[model samples]
Target chain A: MPYIKIDVTREGVTREQKQKLIAGVTDLITEVLDKDPKLTHVVIQEIELDDWGYAGEQVSVLREKGITAKKQ
Target chain B: MPYIKIDVTREGVTREQKQKLIAGVTDLITEVLDKDPKLTHVVIQEIELDDWGYAGEQVSVLREKGITAKKQ
Candidate 1:
């Protein structure tokens, strides 16, 4: 099975949007990768702005550089 | 900060394969999405064949359909 994982910051996405994203992603994988939709697994997680860090800097600072943003 | 989570079955990928996958993915995100490699957080989780379910079917059976194969 082709195991796929997607990790995205949770700032811009809403509950409904997240659901749509998941379904769309599954469909995309099925269509392009030819994976079985029935056999594919999807997971979505919400993270706080303060908890994630990148490149020796916290996300809050990264946002100043236009490198990170809330999902919305 | 985009909290991206990836969950995949741990059948086909090796330690080196996993590391390469992670780096390749980070590069992909940076190049395609314009996200900073420093600010991005990557997570890789290994799931068992028995744990992942799709379309109401377990992955073990899904493999029989050729929908999924060990990563190789």
Candidate 2:
């Protein structure tokens, strides 16, 4: 079983977006890793700004100073 | 750096419980894996019943049928 966990900031992600993520990840795993789609589990987690940290500072504090953690 | 993610169903998990989980997991990793606690990141994610699937069915549907996923 291939279990994928995706963590993102709690920035108003919609249900449709979550569905797309699950489907896309499943497809990717099946295509690349050759995992069974039925056994693939994609879990999405949205962390609050205050809970996530970067470079020894909370994300909320970083946002206050105009610093952002980009997905790349 | 060690990043640990714990996923559980959204079933009224309290904030105090989450704090305990973080501390307990950190201590476990430090003792077992010898990882630095400062570099350890423990994230807890609670999934909706409808979002988590098991046995080819959604968790909510399984719950309606008196089936539960246990932590082991």
Candidate 3:
């Protein structure tokens, strides 16, 4: 019953990357939390820039102003 | 900060429904957990049937066998 939710910006993430993330997170939880992989659920959510907020401003607007995740 | 994630099958959820879910969940957390609505983040994830697993089988395969969520 280990449920993990990963939220990332919709920034052209590949299917392969998503698969790796799911597998890696599942393994990490199994090792650290002593959870069963079969009972673990890893959900990835790709949030739109406009929908994601930071410091009371939309990420889309921040990106337009040249403030990216890497800069932050 | 309070982060809430809601996962459901990718079954034609509308924008209005998503908005209602976000608002309702924020309000619920504020009331029950005493969390500030401004610090709350509600994410809605729509998962494909092929990606979701149940009873050691993918939901798509289970659906083909007529094992729906309602039945379980």
Best model number under lDDT: 2
> All models, DockQ values?
0.22, 0.14, 0.12
Output the TM-score of candidate 3. Answer: 0.57
Chain B only, TM-score of each candidate: 0.71, 0.87, 0.83
Q: Write the per-residue lDDT of candidate 3 for residues B1-72, one digit (tens) a residue.
A: 899978898868999999999999999999999987999999987887655544334556667888777744
Docking class of 3: incorrect
Q: B1-72 in candidate 1: lDDT tens per residue?
A: 444455667665567765665665565555444556765666778788778786788877787777654222
Candidate that scores best on DockQ: 1
Instruction: List runs of model 3 lying over 4 Å from the truth.
Output: B1-6, B11-45, B49-72
What is the Å distance of residue A33 in model 1 from its true position? 11
Superposed Cα deviation of residue A65, candidate 2 (Å): 2.0
TM-score of each: 0.51, 0.55, 0.57
Model 3 alpha-carbon miss at residue B5, Å: 8.0
- Model with the higher DockQ, candidate 2 or 3: 2
- The deviation in Å at residue A42 for candidate 3 is 0.6
Query: Which tens-of-lDDT digit does each residue in A21-50 have in candidate 1?
Result: 566555544543345576566676656556
**Residue pairs with backbone atoms closer than 3 Å in model 3 (clashes):** none
Candidate ranking under lDDT, highest first, comes to 2, 3, 1
Could you give the fnat of all candidates in order? 0.30, 0.04, 0.00
Q: How far out, in Å, is residue B63 in model 2?
A: 9.9
